[model samples]
Target: MATSFIVVLLFIALVGYTRLAEAVSENPTASQIRFLLDEDAALRQKLHTRIQGLRQSVSTLNASIVPCSCPLPTTPAPRTQVSYTGTLKSTMSSLNAASVFNFTGDLINVGAPYTPHDAHFVAPVSGIYGFSLAAYMSPRYYVYIDLLKENAPILHVKTGHYYSGSTNRQVNLGTNFVLTNMTKGDHVWAKYSGGSAYLFGEGVSTFSGFLLYEL
Candidate 1:
């Protein structure tokens, strides 16, 4: 009860008219009362305007923000499933882009339609994604397998002899990304790190695989 009374008193003091009453003398002149009343009204207006402005600012801030309590998919996903595969007998030239059409690879083994480093795959599910890559480089060669969406590169790996004999390494695509961001018909593929290096799988090795997620 005491706390409630104190709160009510505080609220009363915040009002300009009540504050003026507190400042009034027991025997105040009429002119003094008028001037004090005007001042109180002015102060009240200022306080009211300030409160309104603060409310507007808060509303604007809330309007610009979006809350996400659930999972979000990665943007511009690779593909649902590769409808095509192109082999690379040679490295992809600077001007070459593999697939905008069938959404597949040039070939599982050869390097022609696109570059040799990457193989293409399509999305099979709609959810979050965790991608991993595994491949072996020949004793004297180097190879890199990178996942790509449309033309952008996603997950990638590098190994060769400079330090030859390295078989497989798995890399994270960062937890922030999800496979569901990829549309059902999006295109995804791997691009070669370099072309001239010796490759054991070349156009045929199935050392690499891609995975899609949902949830």
Candidate 2:
């Protein structure tokens, strides 16, 4: 009976040993579990580094981009302004019949629209213009000058004896501020009235004009 009992106890011990060996094989070792945790931690750090690098690249690109907020330069328009001033150098006396006065001296002739040869101002462009003239006479002489546009007169200026009796007096007659609208190629000149008329020169007699604005 003692031998049989000892044999049964040995069989129970062998069965328990087999079950413990299977449990150890089915579960993992401590070293394997630690290695798996370390590998997982390294992968998470790499993923975090890649995400930070992408964020930095996006920030750098945004900083390098330039904003289009500054205003651009604009071109200016063209300007057109023409002017002329002329005078006579010598005296004009005894004008027989109505005739155009010729200006021989020039102070300012911009654009060369006024010519001494033609003694007229031809319009270079269509615009409103302002013209002026000053005439000087000595003693009891009478003078009549007209601002002529084409063949007809537009403005008249006359200087006569302001005082009665024969007195030696010098007088200045001026046609100031005659504004007229002129087209291109139109002519403007000064005409002297017929008969005995005298005009003093030496820059005292002047003719000036300017283009006010374009049409």
Candidate 3:
């Protein structure tokens, strides 16, 4: 009987020990190291989430606006008005034998020396002005005439009516082609087509004027 009782007591002690071990394994505080590791993992996750939010906020702030180095340049507006470019023929007198129609179409006598002359002009307004001249020819005489800019001859049209015919009557002398190269205060005039060609106008005068243009 005593032997049987001792064996039963030993078996009961072993079963109690096994139950205690299982309870200890389920209890988090029993292994303080494992409990701290879980807390550390949670802290790391929170820190990572905060950092990601901060980074996203910083990126959002950077994308809020655009930057530039310098401002755009301004341009000036154009002026509106007619600007004169041709030589101004000045004469207070009428076209006579001496002046020989030494005048512009408006009766302004483009006076004397009968050489190339520059006209003083002001840009009436900012614009590109064209200048041109018309040369009338006489059929009876061989005439050599030219248009000049600042005394530099540009146009030269001559007729050999005298050499080709003997009539004192006016023949197909010639007329000037169109010229538009003009600028404000750019003097324009005409001269003797400097040569042996003996050519003269009906009024014994030549002329030049400005032609202003715009699109």
Candidate 4:
């Protein structure tokens, strides 16, 4: 009977100890709760500071951005300048009068207004133009070449015949230059208006022109 009472007391003490442990576990200590609350407040402050810094960085970047002030690209105006020079590569063998002297060799053909196919320079723009003709003829023959505008003679150069046994049987050279107003698409060329001769080539015969000023 004394042993039974002792067992009952021991069981009651065990139950009390278990209940105390459960209460301690379920209810955190005041120091621990204070520490957790302090940690939460510190984390909130750090997050707020980080968010503010990010917003400030974004604002600074946006303020530093600059817009372009340069002009946009544009198409360039078509060049009105025109110039060309053509020469005969081979001699004209017994060429008839009233024929066009076709200069088949190109020395400088800027703007590409001159064509060897028709031996004519079609003006690309309206302007005052200067035309030049430097021609050479064979010995004992005379040549009269005309710078013609639209098939109408505007300038002339003539080569004289060599005197017989006068020690001057050399080839003759004739050159002339003229300026005239020309409209766009007007044709210019050198024509053998009158000659009993052959046009000497090998770069000795040439026709050239250029735009002086646009009108």
* CA-lDDT, candidates in order: 0.47, 0.74, 0.45, 0.78
Q: Name the top lDDT candidate.
A: 4
Off by over 4 Å in 3: 1-59, 62-64, 76-103, 106-131, 165-173, 176-186, 193-215
Number of the candidate with higher lDDT, 3 or 4? 4
Which should have the higher TM-score, number 1 or number 4?
A: 4
Candidate 1 lDDT, 145-174, residue by residue in tens? 556777688765665455326745332111
Clashes of each: 35, 0, 6, 0
TM-score winner, 3 or 4: 4
Two-way lDDT contest, 2 vs 4, winner: 4
**For model 2, where is the 10-residue window of minimal lDDT?**
1-10
lDDT of 3 by residue, 165-215 (tens): 653534453545544454444554445543334434344333434334433
Q: Which runs of model 2 end up more than 4 angstroms from their true locations?
A: 1-77, 162-171
Error of 1 at 144 (Å): 2.5
Best-first order by TM-score: 2, 4, 3, 1
Instruction: Kindly provide the TM-score of model 4 when superposed on the true structure, using C-alpha atoms.
Output: 0.59
Model 1: what TM-score? Answer: 0.34
- Pairs clashing in candidate 2? none
